[model samples]
Target chain A: MSKVMVVTSGKGGVGKTTSCASLGAALAQAGRNVVVVDFDVGLRNLDLVMGAERRVVFDLVNVVQGDAKLPQALIRDKRIDTLSLLPASQTRDKDALTEEGVGRVIDELREKFDWIVCDSPAGIDKGATLAMRFADLAVVVANPEVSSVRDSDRIIGLLDSKTRRAESGEAMEKHLLLTRLDAARAARGEMMKVEDVLEVLAIPLLGTVAESPDVLTASNLGCPITLHSPTSPAARAYTAAARKLLGETVTVTPAREKRGFMSLLFGKKAVLQ
Target chain B: MSILNFFSRNRSAPVARERLQLLLAHERTLAGKSDLVALLQREVLGVIARHIAIDPDKVIVKLDETGHVSTLEIDIEVPEGALARG
Candidate 1:
């Protein structure tokens, strides 16, 4: 059966687009037909993250407005054959996205793909609500911080009350994707621990991506980290998350802290090594 | 700064977590009813003021929830001997 997932966070810049791209690529690499739809409307960035910005001839607005068809707007990823992207229009605002039109697009997408990943816009607005309207599952992305966790809680409230599944009295499965976690900082009491975030959000954890330069490198290359640097810490975390999403029981490991030369020489654990 | 203050400042995560818990609890209780809460506070204060000399600024009306149960909490401060005047 096909599943629709929304990658969202009420707070902005918490790696929603990054999670959407990486998870979509990871699932496609696992041989699942995945289409990631960007729902950010005027502030579209998913196409750039997927490295298909130049190929965006028609966008989601075009399809919803009936100016173009679904197939015509979907940009197939050049590297991943099973992966495709439906970019949002930068020229149109969120008001251009009508609920009825978005519902029609999502219904058509359900018949064609194994997984439909929607990259929701930030904030609780029409765009965000529409993105999650047809979702069976939600990946609430957040950083291990006060603002991010608090905003994620608000998003969770909306996910439980505003979505179509919620309105129909069906439970919407929610998972927390805690990204940009610096293990060393978290240990030093500078950032929230994984357990603390989970306790507050009260959702099952999907996975945690470490704070690493590799993420920026992948974004710069316009390729999903899973494909750009498969062995990198962030990529491994995302791949494990994708596996868990597919109902596989995979043990999630914390992102390894990069040891500096001084720590490597003088750290107590280093002596044993 | 004193050493104790320095140590207290080091653990910011716990402080953030505690604040978020309180904030989320307050926000969740008032979700979709902030306007109603404000109106209720004003109307309840009005009725109370008609019978007692109370400071409107000091009065607080809020909804607090523990687990599944929600309670409407009202705290009013009246000056001493105001009951005799009323």
Candidate 2:
């Protein structure tokens, strides 16, 4: 059966878009047909992150409103054969996503794709709710900070109460992807450790993405981090998370500190004198 | 242990977790209280309407909790002499 998962965070700037792009690419690289849909209507960035910015002709709004067909709006990735992107409109507001319209679009996608990853917008408003309304599982992205964790807690609450599965009294599966973790700072007690975050949120840990400049570089280059720098710590963590999501019994490991040139360039302390 | 606790005062996760626990508990209690109040309001309005004339919209039900005890406050507005006429 096809599954719809939402990459969401209650607060903005916590890497939901990045997680969606990376996880989508990783799943497609594993030979599954995956489409990452951008639900952040006005501030559409999934196409840019997926390096398909110039190729967007018809967006999700067009598909939902029946102005364009699904194949016409779906942007197939040039790098990965199985990956696609359903871009959101940059001009329309959240109200453009009507319940019936979104339902139709999602149903069409469900029939065509193996997995649908919805990149939810920040906040607990109509846009966020609509993004997660039909989700079977949720990847709740959070940073290792108090505000981020608290916001994730709120998103977890919404996932339990506001989803179709929740309304039907079925449990909605949720996994926590902790991003932007600084191991050095966490050791110094400046940030929350992975265990602490899991304890506070009370959810299963998907994986931890270490703080890396490669992430910013990849995004700036308009490519998913996994495709851009497949060997980086962040990319590896995302790949492992994808593998775990596929029900593979892999050991969950913490993100490693970068070595070689990466450590020299972005490392906290100099590796050399 | 005291010194360690003092140094850990700036740790933000514990504070956030504590605050969320309180807020979520309060919100849940308030939700249940509101549902109960709605039921009570409907029943009380039905009984009062049989004996007297009052504005149904003007009835108010409030729940206040202190420690383990809770106080239920109700106020219903009736026109002057409506009760006497009943």
Candidate 3:
């Protein structure tokens, strides 16, 4: 069945776009036709992240407002044959997206794609609400911090009350995707532990991406981390998350602090210093 | 562990967890209360109306939280002699 998933976080700068890009690519690489739709509207960035910024002649707003067709707006990824991107418009505001228009686009995309990943804007605003309106599942991204967790809790409340599934009394499936976890900091009690985040959120964890330079490097290069650094920790984490979303019972362990060669040679005391 | 650990205040992880627990508990209750009460009122009216004709406007359903305890208070004003007809 075709599943419409929204990658959302109530707080900004918590890696929702990155997650959407990575997860969409990972799913497409797994042989499923996937289209990652950017719903941030005016503050469009998904095209840059996916390395198709220059290719966006037609955008989501153009399609919605009847200026272009869905096929004209969709930019297929160069490397991944099955992956595509529906870029948001930089010139248009959030009000350009009507609920009916978005529904029509999603329904059309549904007929052609196995997965439609909506990249939601931060905050509990109209854009965010409309992004999740037609979703079958939600990947609630959160950082290991107080504000993010609190905002995620708020988003969870909105998800239960606002979505079509919720209105129709069908349970909306939700998964927690905790990103940018610094294992060293988390272990040293500076950052929230994975268990701590899980306890408060009370949702099944999808995956955890460790804080790494690879993520930034990939984003700067306008490539998905899975394609840019396939062996990198963040890429592996995203791939695992994608598999889990496909209903695979993969065990997800928290990212551990990597020990240096000096630490291994001189024992744990040397690393402490 | 570093000596900085002793000099530092409480571990931030636990503190963050505690704050979220409190905040979410408060938020979840407040956010869901009105909708839940309204739905409960409608469902209760549906059941009551099946057995006796009562004024739906006179039905009152409220959720009051006192500390950790929550009370779902329902008050239905049956018209005078309406009960006698049944």
Sort order, TM-score high to low? 1, 3, 2
Per-residue lDDT tens digits of candidate 2, residues B11-86?
4645555665676556545643566889999999999888887899989888878679998999999999886775
**TM-score values for chain B across all models:** 0.63, 0.64, 0.62
lDDT tens per residue, model 2, A1-273? 889999999999989999999999999988899999999999999999999999999999999888999999999999998999999999999999987888889999999999999999999998899999999999999997777877888889889888889999999999999899876555444466777777778899999998899999999999999899999889999999999999997676676554445334433441110
RMSD over all Cα atoms, model 3? 7.7
Candidate 2 clash figure, as a count: 0
- What residue runs in model 2 are displaced by over 4 Å at the alpha carbon? A257-273, B1-86
- Give stretches of model 3 more than 4 Å off: A259-273, B1-10, B32-64, B67-86
List chain A TM-scores, every candidate, in order: 0.95, 0.94, 0.95
Which CAPRI quality tier does the interface of model 2 achieve?
Answer: incorrect
Question: Which is the better candidate, 1 or 2, if ranked by DockQ?
Answer: 1
DockQ of each: 0.41, 0.16, 0.36
**TM-score of model number 3, chain B:** 0.62
Error of 1 at A150 (Å): 0.4
Residue A10's lDDT in candidate 3:
96
Q: Alpha-carbon error at A179 in model 2, in Å?
A: 0.7
